[model samples]
Every structure is written in C-alpha cells, then in structure tokens.
Target: MIEIVRTSDLVLLGFLQSLLENANIPFFVADLHMSALEGMIGAFPRRVLVPADHVTQARRLIDEAGLKAELLS
Candidate 1:
C-alpha cells in the first residue's frame, strides 16, 4: 500500500475519505489508533493509503478536492 495523505485530524480525514469513496476509489486507513493516541498528545494523526497503482489517482482525487495532499516520503 502507498500512503497518500497523513494528518492527525480524523474529521478532515473522514471528509476526505468520503470524497474518495464517493468517487469509487479504494483506500485503506492506517495508524487509526494514532488519532486517539495523539489526541492525548494534542495531535491525532491518521493515514490514507491505496494500492500502488491507485496512488496517482488517489492523489489526484485529493488534489482535485482542493485539499492539500501530504505525500508520504
């Protein structure tokens, strides 16, 4: 899997994931527990992932939504 975005905000992640799902794109979320863990630390970070082949399309959908994509290094 390839990560397309990373953030601590589950709300924003939910919104973005909904957008991708609505577009019929497949995605997997990782570090979900991190959100809760980070909340205690004052930051909840999660990740959105997809098959390597879908990475480009996923990234495109995110970008087209006018949301900045936090590409994983």
Candidate 2:
C-alpha cells in the first residue's frame, strides 16, 4: 500500500474516503483505531492508503479536490 495522506481532520478523512469509494478505488485508513485509542487529540494523524497500483489515480483525485496540502505524496 502507498500512504497517500495523513491528517488529524476526521471530516476530511471521511470526505476522502467517500470520494475514493465513489470512484471505486480501494483504500485503507491506517492508525484509526490507534488514534481513537489516543483519544482523538490530534496526536496521531490517520493515514489514507491505497494499493500501489492505484496511488497515482488516488493522488490525482485528492489533488483535484483542492486537498493537495493533505496529501503526503
């Protein structure tokens, strides 16, 4: 998996997840449980990961959404 974005913003995470889901790009949100365990204090940024094969497209979609700043690249 390629780590695309890591952020503390849960809303942005959900938005991106939905965007990718609608686009049919498989993805995983890493460290979610860990973040929850940490109490969502903006300590651990949750990661958005996609298969290596889908990284480029996913990045493009994120970038086009004006979320380039959120992308890990």
Candidate 3:
C-alpha cells in the first residue's frame, strides 16, 4: 500500500481515522502504539498511515474539516 500521509499524535491520528472511516475510505495506521509511547516517553511526533487510494479524498476531507489539515481553498 502506498503511504499517503504521516502524522504524530494518536488523538489527531484517531481523528483522521474517524474522518476516513466516516468517508467510507479504507485505511490503516502504523506506528500508532509506538509513536504514542514515544510521544509520552520521548515527546516525539507520532505517525499514522493511509492507503494511497484514499489519500486524495482523505486529504480533501481533512482540509475541509480544518481539524488538522489547514489548507487554503
């Protein structure tokens, strides 16, 4: 699967997951547990993954929500 996007923060990652799920876009998250732990123990950015097929639409939806994806129209 293509790595469309990456991010840290389980909360935000969860939000992204929910967004994708709600949009009917299939996805998978990687390094979630590891990253969350890292963020807690090391305070580093966590990372999440998404399928390449859903990248564009997922990004668009995220941008539309303005949750974390802040993109200009």
Worst 10 residues of 1 by lDDT: 35-44
By TM-score, the better pick of 2 and 3 is 2
Report how far off residue 42 is in candidate 2 (Å): 2.0
lDDT of each: 0.77, 0.91, 0.63
Best by lDDT: 2
Return model 2's CA RMSD, one decimal.
Answer: 1.0
Question: By the TM-score metric, which is better: model 1 or model 3?
Answer: 1
TM-score of each: 0.78, 0.92, 0.64
After the best TM-score superposition of candidate 3, give how far the Cα of residue 9 lies from its true spot, in angstroms: 2.0
lDDT of 1 by residue, 1-73 (tens): 8878887766788897898899888888887776455555636567788998887887777777777545665
Residue 14 CA displacement from its true place in model 1, Å: 0.6
Compared with the true structure, what per-residue lDDT tens digits does model 3 show for residues 1-73? 4454565445766777788788898877655567445546635544444576766776778778885453222
Clashes of 2: 0
Q: What clash pairs does model 1 have?
A: 8-44, 8-45
**lDDT for 45 (candidate 2):** 86
lDDT of 2 by residue, 1-73 (tens): 9899988899999999999999999999998898657876888988999999999999999999999988884
Local lDDT at 73 for model 3? 27
